[model samples]
Every structure is written in structure tokens, then in C-alpha cells.
Target: MKVIHLHQEEKKIIEEAVVQNRQAQHKLYVKYAPKMLSVCRQYIKDLQQAEDVMITAFMKVFVNLKYFEHKGSFEGWIRKIMIHECISYLRVKKEMKFVEDEEFTHEMHNNIESQFSVEAIQFLIDALPDGYKMVFNLYVIEGYKHHEIAEMLGISPGTSKSQLSRAREVLQTQINSLNKFNHGTI
Candidate 1:
């Protein structure tokens, strides 16, 4: 097995990229674009828009490359940029509309657990509204707190909590529907 000195290699690449080396910048882009695009898509819901946001974020990454302090994982920094770009794009498009719905039925039916494929999961998430999707992705997937989500999306903590609850309610309903369909009960 070939041992890779990841710290030394990544440090060297980041150092080069910081100095405005085209190859190193290209390397960083190529390494993180796919994941960053997925992050963008989680918010934007349009493949073309996600790609555009990823490219835009990459440009910002390169422009602000000198500010990276190397105190954390480089990919985390890039992901934050992509996420911010996605939020900014959504804001400019006027697509993020949060509804204040506090009436939540926090219950699951049939007590049946079903394994979901990635495509099915994405489909379920894709079916959610923009506000719920954002909250759900941030709170559930990204492991952020309600207050953190609220601050990121410029809303109140209560709004973030409600959005997450609503997203879960919708997803649970969809899952139940899928389960019934799979069991030939639909």
C-alpha cells in the first residue's frame, strides 16, 4: 500500500493555490466541485443553477484564497462558501419563503421502518418546499442548531424550529405513502 502524506501534500497544494498558481487552483476546484455542487443543489433544486452557484463559489474561493488560515479542513471552508453562494442565489431569486406553521402532528404511522435508496431519499427531500428544504438540510443533514439555522437564513429560531418540524412531518407522510405503495396497499 502506498502511504500518502495527506497533511504535507494538502499543505503544499494550498500554499501553492494561495500564491495564485493555476494548477493548484484547478486541483482544488476539481477536488471539491462535485461535493460543493451537491451542497448548492440541496438549496437551489435546479441542476443548472447549482452548477452555476458552484462555479461562482469557486471564483469567490480563489479570490479570497489568501484569507484561509489553514486552521481547519480546506474542504469545510469551500463547502461554507458554496452554501453561502447558494443562499445568496436563492435570496436574489426570491425563492426562499418561510411559512409560520406551528400546527405539527409529530407522529409516525404503522411503526414500520423501511430502508430507503439514495434516489428515493433525494426525491423525498426534493418534494419539500424551499423553506423546509433549507431548514431540513441545515438542521438535520448539516447538524446545525435551530438558532444557527435561523441566523444563517436570517430568520428567528422559532421559525427555524417550525420549518424543521414541518419538513419532518412532510417527509414522514411521504415515507408512509411510499411504504403503502411498496406493500401494494395504495
Candidate 2:
């Protein structure tokens, strides 16, 4: 994979945007909007809603640009903002519910074949309940720990663990059913 290096002009654009330069800000937006929209879509099922969230996140990013310490990648900082906006949108729209940890005792099994495409895995995840989907995306896809997920979503770590466990079980069941259906055994 070829990495596209940001030229010095790109760095200057960010610096100028930090001071609220409109043209520089537009340049930054044009450069990052497509990638950021894709990130928002991972959390939001609706494309229009994802676009709204991405716009909101970009607004926050521009407003907070002055606070960026330049210690990390600018794209990373922007992506973090997009993720937070998605979580906030989910909280407001879906109102996450936590199942009791004790209720999740089933041992998880992976019935999904390795040959399945990424889209198939994503479709199974998208079928999960809101809470399960959020936890699964944060932990399995985004590499967040249970403690971090709990802090982000204002739930207990045990709740995060339970949701993730339930997500895996549900996904396995769905995959098994799909396999049976494909093989005409259903």
C-alpha cells in the first residue's frame, strides 16, 4: 500500500486553520471529509444520518482545533471526534440498555467460516441490538477495553463485558443459521 505523504503545504493549512482561516479550513475539510464520513457510517446504519453526524463532528473538530497539541496525527484527533459524536448520537437516539452480567453465561463459539467476506461479518454485526452493536464495535473493531467502553458509554465494565459476550453468541447463531440456509439444510 502506498502512503500519501502530506506536504509541508498541508501542514501549513492545518496551522492556518487553527487560527480560523476559512480557506484553509475548507481545504482541510475537502481532504478529510470522505474518510471521516466512512468512519461515521461504521456507527450509524443510515447514510443520511451518518452524514449529519460527520458534519457535526467536523464542526467540533474545527472548533477544537486550537486545543490540538500537535502531539499526534491530526487525522487521529479528527477520527476521535467523529467516534465521540457517533456515540453521542446513538445514546440520544437509541438510549442504550444494559443487560445484567449474570444473564450472560453461554460459552461463545465461532461458527462463522473464515472464508466469509468482510461485508458478511459487518451485516451480522449490524443485525445486533443497539447496545450489543455499540459494545461490539468499540471492543472488537475499535480495540477499546471494557473499562474504556464503560467510561465512554456511562455503563459498568461488567455490563460492557456482558454485552460483548452476548454479541458474540448472537453473531455465531446468525452465522450458523446462514450456513445451514446456504447448504439447503434449514
Candidate 3:
């Protein structure tokens, strides 16, 4: 594992928390909760459900603090925990399924060159089917490789790639329509 040098104050807080210091743990929670919650929200649509997942993730973080070897950024470690929690929650709720690559229709070829806002793009992503949305977010937004996504979702790498392709096709179609509508060309 690569050694990561954290700020002295951050290192001190982590050391204290590792010893089960409640105050230090609370400090860590306060510092990371919002960002972790946002990560949870990306996978969970319901706000309350996302909050619950965040809490569960934090609990795991505290319980497993001793296992953290400071090999990477502390925040990255926390983010991984939160992401795992979200994946667990999604697996239980969605029972994610994947179709074989051969089953997918030919990929749609649409050029989407719109000046849509980030909010609009996010809305379109949220509108995707649950499986597609999860795969899309993991691969596109989170920068995870298809094989990594497959491992996380318990699907084959081909399934992950196909889902991502479908997601982009859908997004492109939506963006094109929006662009046309906005330009009065619809």
C-alpha cells in the first residue's frame, strides 16, 4: 500500500478516533457527512433512504477504523465505504438484472451538442431506469471501469458495457430533443 501523508491535525484526529474516541469520531462525521450523503443520494432517489444509507456507512467506518492503514486519502476511504453501502442498499431494493450484450439493440447514434445546464443533464440521468442509471453513474460519473462496475453490481463486464451504451444512447436522444425544442426546431 502506498503511504499517504495527511495533514498533522487530520492524522491526529484519525488516531484519536481509532481508539474509539467519541468526540473525535463525531468530528470526523461532521466533516464528511455531507459529502458522503451526496454520494449516497447519487444511487438512492429517496432523500430519507439516502440519509439512512449514509448513517449506516458511517457506522461501518467507525467500527472498521482500526483496519484503515492510512494507505490513501482518508476521504477516498470514506467515499468507498459510502459507495459500498449504497450498492448494498440498491442490491436489496432493486435486485439489479442485466441482459446479455447480444440481446441489446444496435446502439443509437445521435449527436447531442446542446448547451443544457448541469441540472438538466442530472435530471435526465435520474429519469433513467434504475439499472441503467446505476451503471451509467458508476462508469461515467464515478470513473469506474466496466469490469469494476461489473464486480460491484454482480454482473458481467459485457453487461456493464452494454448498460453504459444504452444509457448514453438515451441521454443523447433526450439531449437532442431538448436542444431542438429550445431552438424552436421541434
Q: Sorted on TM-score, highest at the top, how do the candidates line up?
A: 1, 3, 2
Off by over 4 Å in 3: 1-6, 102-114
Predicted model with the maximum TM-score: 1
Model 3 lDDT per residue over 1-186, tens place: 233344777888999999999999999999999989888887787889999999999999999998888787889999989988988988888645567673565556555556878667778988887888889889777899988998888888888878988888888878778878888997
Instruction: Give Cα distance to truth, residue 74, candidate 2, Å.
Output: 1.8
TM-score on alpha carbons, each prediction: 0.91, 0.86, 0.87
lDDT of 2 by residue, 23-116 (tens): 9999999999999988887788888999999999999999999888877788888988999999999888875677757456554655444567
Candidate 2 worst ten-residue window by lDDT: 1-10
Instruction: Give RMSD (Å) of candidate 3 vs. truth.
Output: 3.6
Clashing pairs in 1: none
Native-to-model Cα distance after best TM-score fit, residue 132 in candidate 3, in Å: 1.0
In model 3, what lDDT does residue 171 have? 81
Report the C-alpha lDDT of model 1 over 1-186, residue by residue, as the tens digit: 233577778778888998999999989888888898888878877799889989999999999988989898889988888888888998999989997655544433445476898768888898999999989998777788988888989888888888888888889889988888888997
The parts of candidate 2 lying over 4 Å away from their true place are 1-7, 106-112
Cα error, candidate 1, residue 45 (Å): 1.3
